[model samples]
Target: MMLPLLEMTYKELADAFTEQYKKGPALAKALYGEFFKNLNPKAWQAEEIQASPGLADRLREDLSFSPGKIVDEIHQDGLTKFVTELADGVRIESVILPLKTHQTVCISSQVGCRMGCRFCETGKLGLARNLTVEEIIGQVYTARRRYGRSIRNVVFMGMGEPFDNFENVIQAVRVMSDQRGLNIAQRHITLSTAGRIDGIEKLAALNIPNLNLTVSLNAPNDDLRGRLMPIHNTVSMVRLQQALRAYPLKKGNWLSIVYVLIPDVNNGPEHARQLADWLQPLRAKVNLIPFNPGKNAPFRAPHETEIDSFRRQLIARQIQVQKRAPRGRDLMAACGQLGSGIRQQGLN
Candidate 1:
């Protein structure tokens, strides 16, 4: 006879163990091992678990542990989500964005970021830790099971720097994109980075087709960039631009040059000219992201008139530019703003 398989995730298993045995993961593991002591390892399979039937109350009463808010979000898609809190404390925030067209799962490479880009909320937390390969892939599995939606896009612009944790980051990417696994089309995937020079060179070697890139270029030059994004001080503008110019991927659309326009800092006409002069020869389209300050950020959005003038400069220079509108602000979930507790804390 085939052995009975355990249907719960690592998180659920750990949680259940704590409730029943009162403080012993080993005891729980041994008990669970006994429960599945039959013979067929190959038959054990993973599935998206949507419902818990009547086990919720019992489990809650026993363990006093509950699903995180992100778990609720996943279930909103009418699918099952299974999350695993890895041995490491690197919290993985993930969800399957279910839409009529396609499904996309956002994955975090690090628990937090060390880059400390002033405009980003995740950067404010300080660096916690880098996620392992299994943790990175867990985000995908959780999303796939919860909504039964086919995830088409994989964006690296989540909780941490994908390139900083290069080895695991690349390994996870390879595993997730493999034909035997998620098999998501390269065209639908994008990797966003805050200008990591060596990482750029490493990515260039892959030369994966249809894999798009987005560089966070908030300032036009070294002086301004160094002020807003400390990474600029470490990775000089000359080196970053050289990386962009020599990026291995063949052409399609210009790589997205994300420029976050703070109210008075990078919004003036002179700033635009400087930006245009720098970008006129680069192979990229500019994406103007109006600065939306977080709880502790010292920034504000630019005025419409000032933004219009900025766009005109790029257009006049024959450089493609698009001022991207802010979305999910009601949830503190816009560009340059993620995991900021804007939603749950009701900070608005």
Candidate 2:
């Protein structure tokens, strides 16, 4: 089987090159240092490499090449969403948000999700399969190539429960952040999970630097959370709390507790208070995400008055909290708004 060169970490790239070609690390560095930094498709065709003629062509042709093609695109309100088709014909959506100072790409780790979060459109599709490391990184590669600017940040917040596809996600992170590859700073990447406690424990044990973790704690208690998120059935709030407490974080840095405010569902003064009490023991900052409109979901976004009241309640309890303004809603590219049109196309 061919190695997905674009998805390999520096160590993996070097080791693979030596094992396959009987060459030293210099060849691997020479190839990746050029391709990753520039992302030029033509680089492999260059004739100046310290290798046999046609070697680059042979390597490119044989390997599982191409990061997938951008089959569809939607741009609105400064957010651009791209639908890419992978080699096996599976499709995924990636979003690019042009912030004031930088661009953030929300990439997916799976074709569809099985978590079955009531608010998420992705969950409605059910699980197809976990994305390979290359397929995950391919989103970033395609975005960078199309936009012609360096991607400043990336979020694993697009279409799947990241921790469910833990190994590929971690491998993709390493390759994307490698000094020889995309070189995205560890701090610039954020992995959001729907309270996957096992994944949280694994990440804590890794003790990687500058990589941020966010848990989608949409409910204040187990009963309400279980109704909203099916993962809560197995990974209870109490178990999730234990895992979060065990997570090693820098002393002042807090874990992001993402609470999607579903009107009349998980949004109330009592819910806010319970949330505050739940987070009191851990270092956490609550991010209040107003629910985005979804075709199948019955919930609605909380009123601004309710949102403010909820924030104030958490503030009164001395819990750090902030409201996340909705983005890319017009294009259905915002949080809980992805997974549109793929089912109709039968990619899942």
In terms of lDDT, the best-performing candidate is 2
TM-score of each: 0.73, 0.95
Cα TM-score of candidate 2: 0.95
For model 1, the stretches where C-alpha displacement exceeds 4 angstroms are 1-90, 95-100, 342-348
Instruction: Write down the lDDT that model 1 would get.
Output: 0.64
Q: Record all residue pairs in model 1 with backbone atoms less than 3 Å apart, i.e. clashing.
A: 48-145, 49-80, 50-80, 79-146, 80-145, 80-146, 81-146
Residue-by-residue lDDT tens digits, candidate 2, 96-196: 98888889999999989999999888888888888988889888887888875557799999999899999999989999999888888888899999998
Per-residue lDDT of 1-348 in model 1, one digit per residue for the tens?
Answer: 111112333344547556653545654344333222211122112111113233333333433211222322424223222333445423445544555787766667777688888888878766778776656765664555454436678778777888899888777666556543355567777788999988888888887757788898888788989988898898787788888888865656568888988878888777888888777668788988888777667877677777788888779878889987654444455566665752233211
Clashes of 2: 0
Which 10-residue window of candidate 1 scores lowest in summed lDDT? 41-50
